[model samples]
Target: MTDPTARPADPIRPTDAEARTLARDLIAHARFAALAVLDPDSGAPMVTRIALVPGPDGVPLTLISTLSAHTSALAADPRCSLLIGEPGEKGDPLTHPRLTLQARAEPADKTALKAHYLSLYPKATLYYDFGDFGLYRFAPLAAHLNGGFGKAYRLTPADLAQ
Candidate 1:
Protein backbone atom coordinates (compact mmCIF):
# COMPACT_ATOMS: atom_id res chain seq x y z
CA MET A 1 0.00 0.00 0.00
CA THR A 2 1.12 3.56 -0.71
CA ASP A 3 1.48 6.26 1.91
CA PRO A 4 -1.92 7.90 2.26
CA THR A 5 -0.47 11.09 3.70
CA ALA A 6 2.13 11.52 0.96
CA ARG A 7 1.29 14.19 -1.57
CA PRO A 8 0.95 12.97 -5.12
CA ALA A 9 3.88 13.77 -7.37
CA ASP A 10 3.57 16.93 -9.40
CA PRO A 11 3.03 16.40 -13.09
CA ILE A 12 6.02 16.94 -15.33
CA ARG A 13 5.60 19.30 -18.22
CA PRO A 14 6.67 18.07 -21.63
CA THR A 15 9.01 20.21 -23.67
CA ASP A 16 7.53 22.46 -26.33
CA ALA A 17 8.76 20.16 -29.07
CA GLU A 18 7.31 17.09 -27.40
CA ALA A 19 4.00 18.78 -26.85
CA ARG A 20 3.91 19.93 -30.45
CA THR A 21 4.64 16.45 -31.76
CA LEU A 22 1.94 14.96 -29.53
CA ALA A 23 -0.58 17.54 -30.67
CA ARG A 24 0.21 16.85 -34.30
CA ASP A 25 -0.19 13.10 -33.82
CA LEU A 26 -3.53 13.51 -32.11
CA ILE A 27 -4.89 15.68 -34.92
CA ALA A 28 -3.46 13.52 -37.66
CA HIS A 29 -4.67 10.21 -36.24
CA ALA A 30 -8.08 11.29 -35.01
CA ARG A 31 -10.87 9.42 -36.78
CA PHE A 32 -13.44 11.55 -35.02
CA ALA A 33 -13.74 14.40 -32.60
CA ALA A 34 -16.23 15.73 -30.09
CA LEU A 35 -17.14 19.09 -31.51
CA ALA A 36 -18.58 21.85 -29.40
CA VAL A 37 -20.32 24.91 -30.74
CA LEU A 38 -22.58 27.60 -29.38
CA ASP A 39 -26.24 27.23 -30.17
CA PRO A 40 -27.45 30.19 -32.20
CA ASP A 41 -30.83 30.40 -30.51
CA SER A 42 -30.04 29.78 -26.85
CA GLY A 43 -26.37 30.76 -26.76
CA ALA A 44 -25.73 27.52 -24.94
CA PRO A 45 -23.00 24.98 -25.65
CA MET A 46 -23.82 21.99 -27.82
CA VAL A 47 -21.63 19.02 -28.59
CA THR A 48 -21.75 16.20 -31.10
CA ARG A 49 -19.54 13.50 -32.52
CA ILE A 50 -17.97 14.44 -35.85
CA ALA A 51 -15.78 12.59 -38.32
CA LEU A 52 -12.39 14.18 -38.94
CA VAL A 53 -9.60 14.54 -41.45
CA PRO A 54 -6.38 16.48 -41.31
CA GLY A 55 -5.54 19.22 -43.73
CA PRO A 56 -2.25 19.14 -45.61
CA ASP A 57 -0.88 21.31 -42.87
CA GLY A 58 -2.15 18.93 -40.18
CA VAL A 59 -5.11 21.06 -39.17
CA PRO A 60 -8.23 19.13 -38.24
CA LEU A 61 -11.13 19.35 -40.69
CA THR A 62 -14.58 17.82 -40.85
CA LEU A 63 -17.58 17.36 -43.09
CA ILE A 64 -20.84 18.79 -41.80
CA SER A 65 -24.28 18.68 -43.28
CA THR A 66 -26.00 22.02 -43.75
CA LEU A 67 -29.10 20.36 -42.27
CA SER A 68 -27.43 19.76 -38.93
CA ALA A 69 -27.89 22.17 -36.05
CA HIS A 70 -24.16 22.24 -35.32
CA THR A 71 -23.43 23.24 -38.88
CA SER A 72 -25.97 26.05 -38.66
CA ALA A 73 -24.49 27.15 -35.38
CA LEU A 74 -21.04 27.17 -36.96
CA ALA A 75 -22.28 29.22 -39.86
CA ALA A 76 -23.66 31.79 -37.44
CA ASP A 77 -20.55 31.71 -35.23
CA PRO A 78 -17.33 30.14 -36.38
CA ARG A 79 -15.76 29.72 -32.97
CA CYS A 80 -15.69 26.14 -31.75
CA SER A 81 -13.70 23.47 -29.97
CA LEU A 82 -12.73 19.89 -30.74
CA LEU A 83 -11.87 17.28 -28.13
CA ILE A 84 -9.59 14.59 -29.58
CA GLY A 85 -8.18 11.27 -28.34
CA GLU A 86 -10.17 8.30 -27.08
CA PRO A 87 -9.22 6.07 -24.21
CA GLY A 88 -8.28 2.45 -24.72
CA GLU A 89 -10.11 -0.66 -23.46
CA LYS A 90 -8.11 -1.03 -20.27
CA GLY A 91 -6.66 1.26 -17.64
CA ASP A 92 -8.12 4.43 -16.12
CA PRO A 93 -9.77 6.63 -18.72
CA LEU A 94 -8.42 9.70 -17.01
CA THR A 95 -4.89 8.46 -17.60
CA HIS A 96 -5.28 8.73 -21.34
CA PRO A 97 -4.16 11.91 -23.05
CA ARG A 98 -6.59 14.18 -24.83
CA LEU A 99 -6.38 17.54 -26.54
CA THR A 100 -8.97 20.31 -26.63
CA LEU A 101 -8.46 22.58 -29.59
CA GLN A 102 -10.10 25.97 -29.68
CA ALA A 103 -10.51 27.13 -33.24
CA ARG A 104 -12.47 29.04 -35.81
CA ALA A 105 -14.41 26.90 -38.27
CA GLU A 106 -14.87 28.15 -41.78
CA PRO A 107 -16.22 26.70 -44.97
CA ALA A 108 -13.47 25.06 -46.93
CA ASP A 109 -13.01 24.99 -50.66
CA LYS A 110 -14.49 21.63 -51.59
CA THR A 111 -12.16 21.23 -54.51
CA ALA A 112 -9.16 21.68 -52.26
CA LEU A 113 -10.10 19.34 -49.43
CA LYS A 114 -12.26 16.71 -51.09
CA ALA A 115 -9.57 14.24 -52.07
CA HIS A 116 -7.85 14.55 -48.73
CA TYR A 117 -11.03 14.01 -46.79
CA LEU A 118 -12.09 11.09 -48.90
CA SER A 119 -8.68 9.53 -48.54
CA LEU A 120 -9.12 9.52 -44.79
CA TYR A 121 -12.74 8.41 -44.82
CA PRO A 122 -13.26 6.34 -47.93
CA LYS A 123 -16.87 5.62 -46.94
CA ALA A 124 -17.71 9.30 -47.08
CA THR A 125 -17.23 9.28 -50.83
CA LEU A 126 -20.86 8.19 -51.28
CA TYR A 127 -22.34 11.23 -49.58
CA TYR A 128 -19.44 13.64 -49.96
CA ASP A 129 -20.82 15.12 -53.13
CA PHE A 130 -24.30 15.65 -51.74
CA GLY A 131 -25.55 19.21 -51.76
CA ASP A 132 -26.01 19.45 -48.03
CA PHE A 133 -22.56 18.31 -47.00
CA GLY A 134 -19.58 20.63 -47.02
CA LEU A 135 -16.06 20.55 -45.68
CA TYR A 136 -15.08 22.87 -42.86
CA ARG A 137 -11.50 23.54 -41.86
CA PHE A 138 -10.56 24.58 -38.38
CA ALA A 139 -7.87 27.15 -37.63
CA PRO A 140 -6.54 26.57 -34.19
CA LEU A 141 -6.50 29.66 -32.00
CA ALA A 142 -5.27 27.94 -28.87
CA ALA A 143 -5.10 24.50 -27.39
CA HIS A 144 -5.07 22.68 -24.08
CA LEU A 145 -3.38 19.28 -24.09
CA ASN A 146 -4.04 17.01 -21.16
CA GLY A 147 -1.25 14.47 -21.32
CA GLY A 148 -2.80 11.92 -19.00
CA PHE A 149 -3.38 12.43 -15.29
CA GLY A 150 -1.72 15.51 -13.80
CA LYS A 151 -0.08 16.34 -17.12
CA ALA A 152 -1.28 19.36 -19.05
CA TYR A 153 0.02 22.12 -21.28
CA ARG A 154 -1.26 25.23 -23.00
CA LEU A 155 -0.41 25.45 -26.70
CA THR A 156 -0.70 28.09 -29.34
CA PRO A 157 -1.44 27.60 -33.03
CA ALA A 158 2.26 27.86 -33.81
CA ASP A 159 2.93 24.91 -31.60
CA LEU A 160 0.50 22.76 -33.50
CA ALA A 161 1.80 23.55 -36.94
CA GLN A 162 3.57 20.74 -38.76
Candidate 2:
Protein backbone atom coordinates (compact mmCIF):
# COMPACT_ATOMS: atom_id res chain seq x y z
CA MET A 1 0.00 0.00 0.00
CA THR A 2 1.15 3.57 -0.62
CA ASP A 3 1.62 6.08 2.16
CA PRO A 4 -1.38 8.35 2.55
CA THR A 5 0.77 11.42 2.87
CA ALA A 6 2.64 10.74 -0.34
CA ARG A 7 1.57 12.82 -3.31
CA PRO A 8 0.29 10.94 -6.32
CA ALA A 9 2.51 10.56 -9.35
CA ASP A 10 1.94 13.10 -12.15
CA PRO A 11 -0.19 11.66 -14.88
CA ILE A 12 1.55 13.88 -17.40
CA ARG A 13 5.20 13.43 -18.12
CA PRO A 14 6.35 16.80 -19.46
CA THR A 15 3.20 18.85 -19.01
CA ASP A 16 -0.35 18.38 -17.78
CA ALA A 17 -3.65 20.01 -18.53
CA GLU A 18 -2.93 22.65 -15.93
CA ALA A 19 0.43 23.38 -17.43
CA ARG A 20 -1.05 23.69 -20.90
CA THR A 21 -3.62 26.11 -19.56
CA LEU A 22 -0.88 28.20 -18.02
CA ALA A 23 1.12 28.12 -21.22
CA ARG A 24 -1.86 29.34 -23.18
CA ASP A 25 -2.38 32.09 -20.64
CA LEU A 26 1.20 33.21 -20.97
CA ILE A 27 0.95 33.30 -24.75
CA ALA A 28 -2.31 35.23 -24.72
CA HIS A 29 -1.80 37.62 -21.81
CA ALA A 30 1.77 38.62 -22.52
CA ARG A 31 2.77 40.40 -25.71
CA PHE A 32 6.38 41.15 -24.89
CA ALA A 33 8.87 38.99 -23.01
CA ALA A 34 12.42 39.46 -21.80
CA LEU A 35 14.86 37.21 -23.60
CA ALA A 36 18.01 36.39 -21.66
CA VAL A 37 21.07 35.16 -23.49
CA LEU A 38 24.64 34.49 -22.53
CA ASP A 39 27.12 37.29 -23.15
CA PRO A 40 30.23 36.33 -25.08
CA ASP A 41 32.60 38.76 -23.38
CA SER A 42 32.16 37.86 -19.74
CA GLY A 43 29.79 34.91 -20.28
CA ALA A 44 27.26 36.80 -18.22
CA PRO A 45 23.53 37.05 -18.74
CA MET A 46 22.12 39.74 -21.03
CA VAL A 47 18.45 40.49 -21.42
CA THR A 48 16.22 42.46 -23.79
CA ARG A 49 12.55 42.85 -24.54
CA ILE A 50 11.24 41.36 -27.78
CA ALA A 51 7.89 41.17 -29.41
CA LEU A 52 6.69 37.57 -29.02
CA VAL A 53 4.73 35.51 -31.49
CA PRO A 54 3.50 32.15 -30.27
CA GLY A 55 3.61 29.32 -32.76
CA PRO A 56 1.35 26.31 -33.13
CA ASP A 57 4.12 24.20 -31.72
CA GLY A 58 3.79 26.19 -28.49
CA VAL A 59 7.18 27.78 -28.90
CA PRO A 60 7.68 31.52 -28.99
CA LEU A 61 9.50 33.15 -31.88
CA THR A 62 10.74 36.68 -32.50
CA LEU A 63 12.52 38.96 -34.91
CA ILE A 64 15.69 40.43 -33.50
CA SER A 65 18.38 42.74 -34.76
CA THR A 66 21.95 41.54 -35.03
CA LEU A 67 22.96 44.74 -33.25
CA SER A 68 20.78 44.07 -30.21
CA ALA A 69 22.61 42.96 -27.10
CA HIS A 70 20.46 39.87 -26.70
CA THR A 71 20.91 38.93 -30.33
CA SER A 72 24.65 39.38 -29.99
CA ALA A 73 24.54 37.07 -27.03
CA LEU A 74 22.55 34.51 -28.97
CA ALA A 75 25.12 34.58 -31.74
CA ALA A 76 27.77 33.76 -29.17
CA ASP A 77 25.66 31.22 -27.24
CA PRO A 78 22.41 29.81 -28.52
CA ARG A 79 21.14 29.01 -25.04
CA CYS A 80 18.60 31.49 -23.74
CA SER A 81 15.67 32.04 -21.39
CA LEU A 82 12.40 33.90 -21.67
CA LEU A 83 10.30 35.45 -18.90
CA ILE A 84 6.62 36.28 -19.39
CA GLY A 85 4.25 37.64 -16.79
CA GLU A 86 1.66 40.24 -16.10
CA PRO A 87 2.99 43.75 -16.14
CA GLY A 88 2.99 45.03 -12.58
CA GLU A 89 -0.31 46.58 -11.64
CA LYS A 90 -1.52 48.42 -8.56
CA GLY A 91 -2.31 45.15 -6.84
CA ASP A 92 -0.02 42.29 -5.99
CA PRO A 93 1.40 41.02 -9.23
CA LEU A 94 2.13 37.71 -7.59
CA THR A 95 -1.56 36.95 -7.73
CA HIS A 96 -1.18 36.51 -11.45
CA PRO A 97 0.45 33.56 -13.19
CA ARG A 98 3.90 33.78 -14.76
CA LEU A 99 6.03 31.56 -16.96
CA THR A 100 9.74 31.25 -17.62
CA LEU A 101 10.87 29.25 -20.62
CA GLN A 102 14.39 27.92 -20.99
CA ALA A 103 15.13 27.69 -24.67
CA ARG A 104 17.67 27.49 -27.46
CA ALA A 105 17.73 30.35 -29.96
CA GLU A 106 18.40 29.34 -33.53
CA PRO A 107 18.38 31.14 -36.82
CA ALA A 108 15.31 29.68 -38.48
CA ASP A 109 14.76 29.05 -42.16
CA LYS A 110 12.78 32.08 -43.35
CA THR A 111 10.23 30.07 -45.28
CA ALA A 112 7.29 28.94 -43.13
CA LEU A 113 8.35 30.21 -39.73
CA LYS A 114 8.61 33.74 -41.08
CA ALA A 115 5.18 33.61 -42.59
CA HIS A 116 3.73 32.23 -39.38
CA TYR A 117 5.37 34.88 -37.24
CA LEU A 118 4.26 37.66 -39.53
CA SER A 119 0.71 36.33 -39.66
CA LEU A 120 0.49 36.44 -35.90
CA TYR A 121 1.97 39.94 -35.64
CA PRO A 122 1.04 41.92 -38.73
CA LYS A 123 2.07 45.18 -37.04
CA ALA A 124 5.68 43.98 -37.13
CA THR A 125 5.62 44.42 -40.91
CA LEU A 126 6.36 48.09 -40.35
CA TYR A 127 9.81 47.21 -39.02
CA TYR A 128 10.49 44.43 -41.51
CA ASP A 129 12.71 46.73 -43.50
CA PHE A 130 15.36 46.89 -40.77
CA GLY A 131 18.41 45.04 -42.04
CA ASP A 132 19.08 43.66 -38.60
CA PHE A 133 15.63 42.16 -38.29
CA GLY A 134 16.08 38.45 -38.81
CA LEU A 135 13.92 35.47 -38.02
CA TYR A 136 14.84 33.67 -34.81
CA ARG A 137 13.09 30.71 -33.25
CA PHE A 138 13.20 29.98 -29.55
CA ALA A 139 12.73 26.25 -29.04
CA PRO A 140 11.70 25.69 -25.46
CA LEU A 141 13.66 23.12 -23.55
CA ALA A 142 11.78 23.51 -20.32
CA ALA A 143 9.45 25.87 -18.53
CA HIS A 144 8.33 26.83 -15.06
CA LEU A 145 4.76 28.01 -14.78
CA ASN A 146 3.66 29.60 -11.56
CA GLY A 147 -0.01 30.21 -10.89
CA GLY A 148 0.47 32.07 -7.63
CA PHE A 149 -0.27 30.86 -4.08
CA GLY A 150 2.22 28.04 -4.38
CA LYS A 151 0.61 26.59 -7.47
CA ALA A 152 3.33 25.86 -9.96
CA TYR A 153 4.24 23.28 -12.61
CA ARG A 154 7.27 22.34 -14.64
CA LEU A 155 7.07 21.67 -18.36
CA THR A 156 9.55 20.17 -20.79
CA PRO A 157 9.81 20.40 -24.55
CA ALA A 158 8.46 16.86 -24.70
CA ASP A 159 5.23 18.25 -23.37
CA LEU A 160 4.64 20.17 -26.53
CA ALA A 161 6.46 17.76 -28.79
CA GLN A 162 4.50 16.46 -31.73
Clashes of 2: 0
Which one is best on TM-score?
1
The local distance difference test score of each candidate is 0.91, 0.77
Clashing pairs in 2: none
lDDT of 1 by residue, 68-123 (tens): 99999998999999999999899999999899999999888887788888999998
- Candidate 1 accuracy as TM-score: 0.90
What would the per-residue lDDT of candidate 2 be over residues 1-162, giving only the tens digit for each residue? Answer: 979999987643445786777776686555689888888999878888889877666667788887778887888889999998874566678877788989999887555676777778888888765777887878888888876756777877765453
Off by over 4 Å in 2: 1-15, 88-90
What residue runs in model 1 are displaced by over 4 Å at the alpha carbon? 1-15
Q: What TM-score against the true fold does each predicted structure earn?
A: 0.90, 0.81
